[model samples]
Every structure is written in C-alpha cells, then in structure tokens.
Target: MNNQTISAQLLSPFNMGDLPLKNRVVVAPVTRSTVGEKRLRFMAKYYAQRASAGLIITEAAVISHQAIGWLNSPGIYTEEQAEDWKQVVNAVHSHKTPIFLQLWHCGRASHSSFQQNGQLPVAPSAIKVNGDYIHTPLGKQAYETPKALETEEIAAIVQDFSQAAQLAKIAGFDGVEIHGANGYLIDEFLQSKTNHRTDKYGGSIENRYRFLGEIITAMTKVLSPNRIGVRLSPNGSYNDMGSSDFRETFLYVAQQLNQYGLAYLHVMDGLAFSFHELGNPITLAEFRQVFTGPIMGNCGYTQETAEAAIEKGDADLISFGRLFISNPDLVERFANGWPLNPLVDRKLWYRLGEEGYIDFPAYASSS
Candidate 1:
C-alpha cells in the first residue's frame, strides 16, 4: 500500500477520550523477564525510544509481594518502585507520549519459589496451572496447586490494585491498564476453567466477574474510570486457558464493562498467542457489539490487518508487541514505507542490559 493509504488508517491521529494521540499505533506491553539490580535502570531510555506510539503500555508490573511470580519483573507495590518508575514516565512524557502502567498478578501462574517464605501462589481455587514449569528465582520449577484465597482475603487484593493505581498516578503515568488476560489472577477468576470458587467470586458469570468488578471499583477511587483500561483474551489458550463458555463469558463481560465508560477495552482478538478453539474465535466486531466505548485490537496485528480492522470499524487502535521490540521507530518506518528490522532472537529478549533491549537502532540511525 502507498504511504498515504498507510498513513490514512494506521498513522492517523485519534482522540482517545480527552487525550490526543498523534497516531493509532500502540506499543503493547512485553515482559523482558529480567532479574536483579539492573531491572529498572535502562527502562527509561527503552520506552523513550519508542515514544512515537499513540499510547505505550509498559510491561506488566506486579501489584504486591504476593503478586510476584515472574522472577525479576517490575513491581508497583513499594514507594521505591514507584519512585523508580517516575523516571520512565518523565522520559516518555518528554517526547509528548502518553504511557500507561499495566497492573498484574500471576496467581496460579506463579511458583512457590517466588512467594514469601516459599508460600504457594494464591488463586480463586486450589487448582494448578496445567503448564509444565515456570521460571522462578530459584530456577525453573514445576507449577504448584495454588492456595485458594479466602473470601475475606479477596478485599486486600482488590485494595492492592487500587494502591497500584494510586502509585501509577504518582509515577506520572497517563493511566493504568489492568492485566486481566492471559490466565493470570483476574483471568483465573473470570474463566470457569480455573475458578471453582463457591463464594461470591465464582460459579455464575456475574459471580466470576465480581473480582474484576471490585478491582475496577477500587481503582476508580484512585483514578477516574476514563483513565483506566481492562484487557481480555476470550480466544487465548495461554497458561492453560480457554473455556467452553468463552463466548457467553466475554459477551457478558463486554456488556457489563460498557457501563463504566473506561478509557478503552483492549481485546486480544488475533491468534498469534494461539486460541482455545472452543468454537470459532470471537472477533473485534463481536466485542464492538456490546461495548460502545473505544476498543483496541491486540496480538499479531500487522500494518495491513490493523488498517483493515480500523477501516471496518472493528477497532480504534492496534497494539503491536514483538514488532515494536525490534523496530523502535515503527511508526516512522510505517509512515515512510521503511522495512522493519528482523525479529530479534528469543534468547536475547529477556536478558538484562542493552543487547536486544535498547540497542535496536531507529531507521534513520541504522541507515
């Protein structure tokens, strides 16, 4: 496609709520999965490099100590962590780019090695993730059956989300996105495949949604609904997800989320992450039916497909993950018809330091 045609769809400016985006391209959150003292250092420069995106969602940041699962992933619980994040926000903001922090919890996707006193991870039920192993501080370990959260204990986790939102605001993030997808804590509660709670947090669809509902409600106290976003993966099979009632579950979720007037509803509609194949995958057009607010289509979208989806009114924005890693100047390349850099090696992805993380030169510099 010609540059004009490409710019018309993907590069077009958009007003996401009251925020003005220079373009519709977004930088999706990607976990580098690094550990140690170097974890938070280079992030500022890394994000600033890709500030051209309409919106930038940082890699998932665990909300609290209990939420810890990824070996060396960033966290939002401590004031120190929030303080460190301020540098990243300032760096991105210096380029006039809006960035959002993705709040996350690993839940049953975690191993006891990452937990306090070797305590087991917490989930809605005492079920183990059917996956073989997970990377923990001690090393790769077998997935353990998580301890079922007590009904009363649920409130603390909800508050942790709220507190994380508060810290995101303090860190100068434009907003926050709740990581409710990919079979994590909230996903465990949302899908029946993992959640078998008899309490208010499980069983019926509404009950299953209660955990996320409470989280959203709590977070809104710290930030307006318009400043928050939630992500869902109805078609995802990651972390042993995918339910037979996926359609009913997500449709009900969209319908309910429509009430909150959120910043946007991010749906991972593409099959890059692999689908559950419970039936035909639920498309962005399906979500558009229930949600009247702005919607972003994520996972495995290319310039052509993202453009087509926008033209068809199926999505307002598209978030690119792997592509953004190698092409720091992705928007510029797309605007000028420059070819994207080849995908980086997978082993280089999660390692600490500059190699694959921030060393990818922009198109101009590379030329």
Candidate 2:
C-alpha cells in the first residue's frame, strides 16, 4: 500500500458549514497553562507555528469569573483578556488559518484556592469528585465537596456563556466551540450520577439537556448557528461520571443538536486501553445518521487511524492532541509521510514559562 496515497486522502479539503478547511487534519484543544498577558504573546508564536493545520481549536477558555476554577487558564470575560485574544486571533488569521475558541467552565473540577475569595467549587450537586487532586497555591490536595447551583444560578450561567460568545467574536475568533464535555459543568448536568435534583434542571433526559440546550440557544443569539460548535464525551468516565443509559442520553442530545444546524459536533471517545473500549462511539457514518453537519472525532487517533476514519466516512475531520504538541508541522508531516517527533516531558505541560510551551522546534528549525 502506498502511504502517500493514504496521506493525500487524509489531507484533502473538507467543508464545515460555510468554512472550507485546507485539509482534513485539525489541531485539537489542549490546555498548557499558557495564559494571561504572557499567554497572549506565547499563543501568537505558538499558533503561528502550527498554522499548517486545516483548522485550529484553542485550549478551553473560561467565560466568567465564577466559571473559572483552574490556575493560569485564559478567560474571555474581562476586557483585558478579550483584547489579549484579539492579538491571538490576528496572528492566526495573518497566516490565513481559521481558529475556534473552546469555551469552558471547570465546575466541580475546581479547587477553593482557585475560586474567588477561596469560595467552594460549584457543581450540579454538592458531591465531591472521587479520587481527584487539585492544584493550590500551597500544593496539590484532594478535591473538596462543591456547592450545588440553584435553579436561578443556572440561568445566570447561561447568560455568562452568551456574553462570552459575544466576547469571542469581538476577539476576532472565527467561531466558538462550547466545552460541554470532559466532566465539566455542562457534563455535570448531563450525567445523572452527578446531577441528582428534583428541580427542572435534573431527573429526565430532557431536563438534563435543558442546560446545554439553553446555553446553545443563548450562544446562537450572539454567534451564528453555523459558526457555533459543541464538544461532548458520551461515555466519558472522567470526574466519576456515568449514567444508567449513556447511549440514550447522548442520542437525545445529538438528535436535538441536529435541529440547530450547527457547524460541527466534536466528540471525545473517552480514554480507553484500546480503541474498541470507546463507548457511545459515534462513527462519522453513525453520527451522520443523526447530525447532518460535519463531525470531528478525537481520542487515541493515529495518522493511519484518522485517515481511515475520514475514508470510511466515519468523520469529516480528525483532531490531533499530543501529535500536534510535538509536531508543529503535523499537517506537513502527514502530507509528506514524514516520521513524527516523540512527545517531550509531561511535567512541563503545565509548567509556567516557555520551556515546553513555545520552545518546541518546528521541522524548519530542525532542518
């Protein structure tokens, strides 16, 4: 089999709504603690380095002060942050690359030390995530019980997302991808195990989906339906999350999202020992059955696997995480069938400064 032929197939142009990708290869969102004033400067160089990708999805960015629970993660709620992002958007666009910001909220995954005035973490329930540690100014410690959000508070959260979407547009982002996956606040509401309430926000599947549906509706008011996207993890067990009926929950969400005519649906197929272990695994062909829009599939994908997914019509595009981290010219590597560089030290992933964040040499530099 000619690897070049396979590589060409993977690098072919694809469409998501009105946006045409240069190739099917996408750089997935990966948080690396590169934010604040320094983050703006670093991202300009960082994204500019990987401009070869067909599309670039930035790391999850908090939308509100209350929504923030992680250290050093960027936010779009403030004027300064929005202005900082403007530079990032300008840099990526200068290279003619379309970029999307992943809007996020940490929910119960946050530590009090990271909260305002050291307030408790918030979630759908007051439950504490089992066997998880959070970083504090002092050091890493076990997660604590989170404060349950009231029905009224939920409405406020929706408004925060809407405001954030507007800010993203102001920042010159091509689009906004709602971070509803990976056991975050939105995922907390989706999982029955995490959300145990008798109010309108909990219980039935429709009620559980109400939070996400409202957020999407609110965001669409600010961003066009075609310019908006959503990310989900149907069978993700992260943050001690699960449901009695995972497939039914995700199917309902997918079918409903299809009605909105969104740009794409990005799905994370939980961390599995093998690809076979990925549950609620919505293949590109399977997802097309429910959602008429484009689909981006992620998790444990190799170059060959991603190409096969696109060829088999399992996905319109493939999202690369660690591969993009090590290979700034991943699209070029895929196009030419060049061997990829191995990932550097994991300890440096969140470490401040440019040691691992911006110091990775590109293929040109290596040559």
| TM-score top scorer | 1
Candidate 1 yields a Cα-based lDDT of 0.92
How much lDDT does each candidate structure score?
Answer: 0.92, 0.82
Alpha-carbon lDDT of model 2? 0.82
Candidate 2 residue lDDT tens string, 212-267: 99999998889889999899877577767767677778778888998899989998
lDDT of 2 at 178: 93
Model 1 misplacement above 4 A = none
Poorest stretch of ten by lDDT in candidate 2: 270-279
**How much is 317 displaced in model 2, in angstroms?**
0.8
**What is residue 320's positional error in candidate 1, in angstroms?**
0.4
Superposed by TM-score, candidate 2 places the C-alpha of residue 135 at a distance from the truth, in angstroms, of 1.1
Q: Per-prediction TM-score, please?
A: 0.98, 0.95
Write candidate 1's Cα lDDT for 1-367 as tens digits.
5877966878889998888999999999899975355347689999999999999999999999899888668999888888999999999999999999999999999988878898999999998988778887778888899999999999999999999999999999999999999999999999999989999998999999999999999988899898899999999999999999999999999899977889999999999987899999999999999899999999999888899999999999999999999999999998888999998887778887677888899999879
